[model samples]
Target: MRLVVDLNRCQGYAQCAFLAPDVFAMHGEEGLLYTPEADEAQREKLAQAAAACPVQAILVDAVDPPAEAVSGER
Candidate 1:
């Protein structure tokens, strides 16, 4: 599984961190910390985390690889 948090859209609500502590966390003040790649077992937690985002900044399992990466051109 993979996830992406749009920092610009994030409001530091800590919803994701609270819901998915293993994958998302707060890094002092408003700074957010998280792991992009996650274990498949975390899918339910990740989904809950994404849905809990007040700002909807978390995108779970929707990470699209770069065109080159998908095409195996690089």
Candidate 2:
């Protein structure tokens, strides 16, 4: 599965980091570290992490924009 974290909107809540340590982590202060791609086995955890994000910044499985959405093409 794929994942995307909107770092710009993230608030360093650390909820995701606590929920899915394998996929998400806390950096020095407010930065976050995460894996873009995760194992299918981690789907449930990913969901929990995404939901736990206070700012709703995590987008799992939609990391890659759709073909027509890329570069605003039709």
Candidate 3:
């Protein structure tokens, strides 16, 4: 999964950080940082963070399940 944050649209609201500190954070008072490539385990938190964004600047890209999982090999 991939996460995209539009800095131009973000207002440092810190909501994303609050919702998913593992994937998102605020740098000081004027900066925001996030994991561009997030693990599948973070999907739920990422979705919550995206929804919590007042400016809707966070974007989460859907990732396909692992081949083994998809094929039910495990």
Q: Ten residues in a row with the worst lDDT in model 1? A: 64-73
Quick one: best lDDT, which candidate? 2
Q: Each candidate: what lDDT? A: 0.87, 0.88, 0.86
Residue lDDT tens for model 3, 1-74: 87789999999999888888998888999699898988878888889999989999987766553465556555
For model 2, the superposed segments whose C-alpha errors exceed 4 Å read 62-74
Candidate 2 positional error at 53, Å: 0.8
Q: Write candidate 1's Cα lDDT for 1-74 as tens digits.
A: 87889999998999988888999999999899999998888888999999989988888756544455566555
Evaluate residue 35 in candidate 3 and report its C-alpha lDDT on the 0 to 100 scale.
Answer: 88
Query: Where does candidate 2 clash, by residue pair?
Result: none
User: Could you tell me every candidate's TM-score relative to the true structure?
Assistant: 0.82, 0.80, 0.80
Candidate 2: worst-modelled 10 consecutive residues by lDDT:
61-70
Clash pairs, candidate 3, are none
Segments of candidate 3 deviating more than 4 angstroms: 62-74
lDDT of 3: 0.86
- The true-structure Cα RMSD of candidate 2 reads 3.8
Q: What lDDT, from 0 to 1, does candidate 2 have?
A: 0.88
